[model samples]
Target chain A: MLSIKNIVKQYAQHRALDGVSLEVEKGSIFGLLGPNGAGKTSLIRIINQITAPDQGEVYFNGEKLNPDHISKIGYLPEERGLYKKMTIGEQALYLAQLKGLSRSEAIKRIKYWFEKMDMQTWWDKKVEDLSKGMQQKVQFVATVLHEPELIILDEPFSGFDPVNAEIVTQEILELNRKGTTIIFSTHRMESVEQLCDSIALINRSHKILDGKVKDIKNSYRDNTFHLNYSGAFPAEKAGLFSIVKPADSENVTVKIAAGKTPNDLLSYLLPSIQILELKEQVPSINDIFIQKVTQLS
Target chain B: MNKILLIIQREYLSRVKKKSFLVMTFLVPALIIGMYGLIAFLTVKGGDKKAQVKVIDESGIFAGNFKNNSSVNYITTKESLDAAKKEATESGEGFVLYIPANIESDGKIELFSTKKAGLSAVSNMEKQINDLLRNKQLKDAGIDPATLKEIDPDVNIDSIELSEEGEKDSSAGAAYAIGFAAAILIYISLFIYGAQVMRGVIEEKTSRIVEVVISSVKPFQLMMGKIIGVGLVGLTQFILWIVLSTTLTGAAGKLLLKDKIDQVKTEVSVNEAGKTIEQVNAEGPAAKILNAIQTLNLPYILGCFLVFFLGGYLIYSALFAAIGAAVDNETETQQFMFPITMPLLFTYIMSFSFIVNNPDSTLSFWLSIIPFTSPIAMMVRLPFGVPAWEVALSMVLLIAGFLFTTWLAARIYRVGILMYGKKVSFKELAKWLTYKE
Candidate 1:
């Protein structure tokens, strides 16, 4: 488990991160969602020990984070830095050793990762010679080669194409399944919907929403329904439920008032029209994300 | 400690394994040796070319002054001055030395050449005429030339030095060689390793690799690893260069001296005897130099030279590391490096003067003891023996200076490694120096 509590970071006149906090459960994929400059990088830097927060305490596996703790945390900063002149294998081994693996151990791990990623041929190639996607593959291998307890990837999927992104996504899932907690930050909400079990959303340096993905979506749900009926229903006859859009002659999307139940909405609409099919619409994570962020602003 | 060693090992291996480092290491010595050989070859080839001379002795006073050598075919002419000048220019005999009547009174001889007379040929002809005039003056005075020469016995004096520890001193050449070796070692090490640090820092910063490395290791560890690793690489190259150069120089020396080996040995012994005689009759600048050379303590000089060389290199290398971290580019480094390098340059320029005036004075003592200036200044002072305590104290101070400077540099490095965009200034560097974390 990774816990970040009340992290506040101030930079001169600006508060980069203000009272931001979140928890990533064991064997879970946690999404750290925020728009550009919404304190995600500041929080990530603090977690990586690149900088210290003005007021915060981070706990990993029930212990306070320290230099020793850093060895168990794999961090891939969003800027995507690597030594351009160094060969792929050399860089991987160097970073692996820095993360507390011995030389032999690091080499073994790097070989395994290389083979797993089908990048064995790239061992002798310099990073600069590799394409942007290939370099990211090298960096990704370096990050997870040591098998840290937690992996924090800031926009890990940015440079990757869809095929490569799927490959990484599968790897992240496999790692998480094998008991590594992953905290991935990105603006790609679809990835969050696909991979994240829970998410923490920060808007303007504050955590405006956080919880299990299902629970957050459930909490933001307003009783709404979509009906596909052959007969037309008068908008006034729909009672307190307002028709957001009338699709074709056979379909209509409707929103009910706050206190109205699904039965109450059905009771009013059934009398005015022949209901062919009526289904409750559960909001998608993307819709909920956009709504939450916009609401906070 | 293991982690530091790991960092050092990684740095050392990575840099040493580089093709550029290997190329430079071998290339520098080869270039230096090639330059020296080229110069020697050119000198020898230039010296072998011969010139012809035509002499015009108008007074009949210096008629026999000309000598016939294979290189210089000297011809005598008693024709009219205008005719001789015209013949000299037209014939293409290199030059005509016009010796006028009463040349000794005139005190100057005129040489006319088609283009220009070779300087060696002109000087040789002048010396021969001057010797003839001197002999003529001696004969005119009613004194036998041989008798005058016999009476003027060359005075010789033997040099003997008593050491403070009751030991007889050896030749002064050893002292000079030791000082020379020490200064060269210090200069080469500082230059090679300092640039290594600069390049290493620039490489990391330019590639943006420092962002990842900084997350795992503090910038201090990284900087120290680079400095130590590069220093070791420099030492390795130095050792290799010394061995290669020594072997090459010895082989070349043998080849060059092969034909004249026996003649050179006999000539050297005769020269030594002549030097003793000259020392006895010594007057003017030569005698002062001989005295200074005699007073030098060769052993102590050599010892101090080694110590100061190591000390000074470490001190300057630390500063270089700091500069490497502070600047983002090599061009910007020049602005700061000049001030840092000035002390070493000043010490080298003023070295001989310092040795002459007062080798044991307060100025020499302080300059030689300070870490920044010590390598050159101490080597300069070493020839005129410093006290044992002063050497020990200087070593201690130099070590302390290295340690303190390294610590200060590491502090700046920790912050500077990750800093980008804003151009770093002295004022900003001062602020970083005071930053506690």
Candidate 2:
């Protein structure tokens, strides 16, 4: 388990992180979502021990984070960094050793990862000679080759084509399945919907929303319903709820007013048309994200 | 400790494996040997050729003044002076020595060549004329020529120095050569390798690789690893160069001298005569230099040279590493590097004075003890002698200086490695020095 509690980071006249906190359970993919400059990087740096927080503490596996703890955490920073002059295999092995793996162990792990990623032929090539996507693959291998207890990937899928993105997505899931807790940070809500078990959303240095992926969506529910019927609903139904859009066919989506229940909405719609289906449509995480961010803005 | 060792091993292997290192290691020594060989060849070839000149004496007093030589064909001309000058010009070979009538009384002689006569040739001709005049004076005094020749005497003086151990020392020329060689080695190594450390740091910082590496290792470890690794590379190259150049120069020297045995014998005799002449000719300059080198303790000089070289390099390299970490680019590095490198330049310039005034004075002791100036200053004093206690004290202080500078540099490195785009100034660096974290 990785726990970051009440971490506050201030840089002179500006407050970068304002008492932000989040938890990532073991063997789960946790999404940390925020708009640009939302203190996501600051929080990541603190967790990675790149910089110490002004006032905060992070615990990993019941012990306070320290230099010793850094060996057990694999971090892929948002801004990609690799020594351009170093060969791929050499760099991978070097980074693995720095993460506390012995030489033979590092080589073995590097070979295994290279074979798995089908990057065996690229082992002897310089990083500068490799394309951006290929470099990202090498970086991914380096990040997970040590088999750390916790993995933090920031914008891991950026600059990747769809094919390569899918490749990384599969690898990320495989690592998570192998019992590595992952903190995945990105603005891609679709990936969160696909992979994240829970998430925290920060806007303007404040976490406005966080919970289980399903629960957060459910919590932001406004009793919106999607109705499909044979005939038109009553004109009075428009007065009972805020009509989002009325379809040209006999289908419409409506937001029920405050203090109004779905039962009331259904009762009002049932008598006005031959209803084929009247389902309460739960909003997607994307909808919830935009709605929450726009409301704060 | 293990990580530091690992870093050192990687640095060493990676650099040594480079083509640039391999080329320099082999090429530099070859170049030095080739240069020396070229010099020896040119000297031998030039000495084999002799300049030929013809002489003509006009005045009866200067008759028989010319010396006969196979190379220089002396011709006696009874024609008028204008005819002799025309003959000399037509011959296109040698100059005409025109001695005016009663030249001994006038004390004036002239030489006319198509081109200007060389100084050595003109002096030789003048000496022959003076000898003839002296002989004429002897004949006029009614002295026998054979007796006058028998009474002429030439004296030669041989120089020798006794070492403290009662051994005859070699020529002071050899000692000066050794001293110069040691000084140049120290000078080149300190600047070249120290700049290498600085440039390495700047490359890492500019590329932002320091960010990732520093996350795992302490700044002190990184700095030490770089300095030690580069130092080892330098030592390796130096050893290789010494071995290669020694072998090549020895081989070339033998091959060039192999067929010139008779010439070598003659040259050796001439060299001995020349050394004797130099000792008697130049007053006491050669003897003073011989005494200076022979009286000094050789072992102490070498030991102090090694200590000061290592100490000064470490101190300067530490400051370079700090400067590397402080700035983001090479342009910014210049602002700091000038101040750091000034001491080295200053020490090299001031070294000569320290060698002359007092090799064991308080000033020399202090300069050699201080790590910044020790590399050059201590070396200058070593050619002269220094006390054992002074050498030991200087070593202790230099080591201390290296440690303190390393610690200070590591402090700046810790913060500077992470800072970016925030142009760090001297004031800011001063503040960073006080920063506890």
Candidate 3:
């Protein structure tokens, strides 16, 4: 678990994070959603202790974040990097050791991860010899090899193909299921929607939205219904509900009037129109993200 | 501490294992020995090339007067001077020496050749002619040539240096050579190893692995680790070079110059009559050099060298590391490098031009004491012998300077490594210095 309280970070002539705060619950896939240059990286860096916050405190598992907690946190930066001249296994072992693992322990975990990722043959291959996606896989293995209690992955899926992305997604889910807290920072709203139990959407220098995905979606919802019907839309009863889209070629979209219910509208329409399909439209996290960002800016 | 050690180990091993490191380690000593071999060959054998002289002695008094040595051969001809000149030109083989019948009064001689004779060849011919005329004059004056030889003054000035211990034979030339060599080694190693640290920093930054590495260890730890690591590599190479060069050159010396060394012994004994037995018994130029080196107190000088070597490397490499972190790539490093490397470059030039010549001057004293220039400047003075307190003070200041620069560099490095795609100015770097950890 991680808690960032009133985190304020500033670079020269620019405010990177302005009083942004968030809580990452234990054993949850916490999505940190933000646009480019949205202070997400600044916040993540503060949490990782790569840089200190000018005016805030970060607590990891109820203790103030200190150097000792470094071993308990794994960070995979967006620009996935490995020493090009070093072999995959050598670099991985080095990284694992830097995380406070013993040499034998690091090797054991590295072997396990390399096998899990199907990278056994790549142990001796130099990083430059590997494809970008392959390097990403190696970086991924390195990130989780120490089995940190909390993992911070910045744009973890950027260089991955769909297949690898799915694999990484499954790995993240599996890690979470095994009681590991993950802080996944990305702009990929679909993954956030798919994997995140909770998220904090940051825009510019502020956290614009924070909550469970379903609740946030429900909070933005209106009583709008999408109808697929091949029938005459009764012109006189149109005043009962405002038509968001007119009945054109077997589809009608409308928002029900405040005093009416969906059953009442259906009853009123049953005589004139035979509905093929009627369903309430729930906004995807992608739409809500776009709408919220556009509104805030 | 453990993490820093780990980082140092990784940095050191990664570089030391490189093929370039191995190649340079073995190849440089071979190349240096090869170069010295060429010089020795040229001095011993190239100088022995025979030059044939065609002599047309018109003076009957000078018949069969010229003598031949290893470097020059004289052949008397009965042909006329113009005919000998023509023959020499046509043959294109050697000079034509002509002595006129009025040689006893005018004491003049001439040489004609198709090509210009070497200065040594001309001088050798002059000496032979001068000696022949002198002997003839002495005989005419009724003085014996043996008496003239006995009266010849061959005064040898034995330069014995007086020090606190006692009078010891000293060669200023040898001291100059050793001091200059040590200073140059420090100067070159500082640049070579310091630049390597800078390039390593830039590699980690450009590769974006610095972030990953720093997250586990402090920036200060990482920077110190890299500087120490590269410096170890430099030290290892230096030690290996010393060992290899000495061994190889020693073997080559025995193989190529066995006769040359014996010749030096005989040459030394020939003119060393009035000197002490110690001077004559020193045997040869090689043994004298060995004595000079021994008198220089090599262990003390080497101790100072090791301290300043690491100290200088630590100081300069900290700056280089900071510069590397401040820039995005190697090309961008130039703008930042000039100010940092100025002290090093200035001291290197001054070590050769000023310090070596005036090791005891007030300027040399200050140059050797200041931390920035001391590493090289002190080396220039070390062979001449520096006071103990001055060396101690310089070393302490160097350590202080190293700590200060490393602290300054660490501040910039932590912030700079994460920054990308921005043209970093001096002002920007100053701002980074003010940034929080």
The numbered model that scores best in TM-score is 3
Q: How high is the lDDT of residue A262 in model 1?
A: 70
Q: How many clashes (backbone atoms < 3 Å, residues ≥3 apart in a chain or on different chains) does model 2 have?
A: 0
Best by DockQ: 3
State the DockQ, from 0 to 1, for candidate 2.
Answer: 0.35
How would you encode candidate 3's per-residue C-alpha lDDT over B242-309 as one tens digit per residue?
99999999999788888766765565666455332333433446667878877777788888889998
The number of residue pairs in model 1 that clash at the backbone is 0
Error of 3 at A266 (Å): 2.6
Candidate 3 regions exceeding 4 Å error are A235-240, B43-49, B52-70, B73-96, B112-116, B131-159, B263-291
The Cα error of candidate 2 at residue B47, in Å, is 1.8
TM-score of each: 0.84, 0.83, 0.92
> DockQ, in order, for the candidates?
0.47, 0.35, 0.76
Displacement of the residue A32 alpha carbon in candidate 3, Å: 0.4
lDDT (10s digit) by residue, model 3, range A11-53: 8889999998888899988999878999988888888888899
Candidate 3: docking tier: medium
Each candidate's chain B TM-score? 0.78, 0.80, 0.87
Instruction: Provide backbone clash counts, one per model.
Output: 0, 0, 0
